[model samples]
Target: MSLRFADGDFQSAWKELDEPQLDGGWELFTETMGVQIHRLYDEETGLYEYKVFGVLAACTPELCADVYMDLAYRKQWDGYVKELHEKDFDGQKAIYWEVKYPFPLSNRDYVYMRERQDLDMDGRKIWVILAKSSTVTPCMEKSGVLRVKDYKQSVALESDGGCGTKVFMNYFDNPGGMIPPWLVNWAAKSGVPGFLTDMQKACKGYANYCQKK
Candidate 1:
């Protein structure tokens, strides 16, 4: 499923994503193995607002919470790195940090507990969760192609298929007026194949780190 943002349509898309879908399976999976940050850039104030989400797999709720908290902290630190290393479109530089506590939007305290909640919500839940964290990284005049910026550059574990966790990573870029909706959708969809490949690599590294410790 792909969405396009036109003149007045952009705001409509934003409105369309108001309430979260609350998917049981995705919620379970995310509650088990996902972390995300939703950030917004205010050009007028020159400040950024950030919201974070994370889930960890563990036998006990306490352990899962602990791991999740640690992961959140790690993400905060990683965001610092991203800001430090981020390069602006004009080759200029800017730095910023989170302004609020990372909110927890789920009830599952552990991987086991998540099973109690419906993990088969027909996919609506995951969409809700994703919309909350999704960011629109607009295209830069200097960089003709849309690029995902401020990403933590990590990997993910997959269990749908394959023998082990498949790699996972995310990127977001807004093509702005430069690219039409059709082309933007086409380009965005076209990049998925290669993006997933790189994500797998990052996920593998993360899986290793998680296992080692």
Candidate 2:
């Protein structure tokens, strides 16, 4: 598909979060470190889609966007990343990521296309990063690794008044295996918060890393 993301995609997500119906619509999962996690269940896939809102204290929108797009820097902070790189498949640029899983479960890999847009909404700068799985890529599957065929993620970043960023993320993916639904839900509920924590730490040291380069 297309690498670009429409503004409505993020705006609609924000609207849902703004007027939350926690009873049936977006259920509250957890909150930690200025982050709130909400989940919506899909009847067809029996999987949960996540909407996350957080503030990266003391971080600028530029820095947060840079850190999100920097695959090299991700390897240093994200321990679960087994492999990550960008490649061109018949002139179409895409990213390949292999993530490590716990024991007894196979690792997961994703081939996805991503795009970033710097938007000016009423004179306010908002950085949006959108990514989704691409089936057109000719990348071969690795043995013992499960390729995640369905995945999509979008993140919106904006300034939170003084030297901080407000982040909103909408993510969904299907592991495509015999994995239990409860296990998947549990992983997301726990893993998402941990990721945001790691991201904050990564942002803090990003300037230093750039200086050394």
> 1-213, model 2: which lDDT tens digit per residue?
446557677665444334543566788888877788989989989888888888888889888999999999999999999999999988889999999988888999999988887777678888888889999887999999999999999888888889888888889999887887667867777789888888889999998998998
Would you estimate the TM-scores of all the predictions? 0.26, 0.91
- The lDDT per prediction is 0.28, 0.85
Clashes of each: 14, 0
What is the C-alpha lDDT profile of model 1 across 65-169, one tens digit per residue? 222223333453332122212223233222222222122211111000000111122442211111111123222222222232322212122232323322223
Tell me how candidate 1 scores on lDDT. 0.28
Q: Which candidate is the best by TM-score?
A: 2
For model 2, the stretches where C-alpha displacement exceeds 4 angstroms are 1-4, 10-24
lDDT: worst 10-residue window of model 1:
107-116
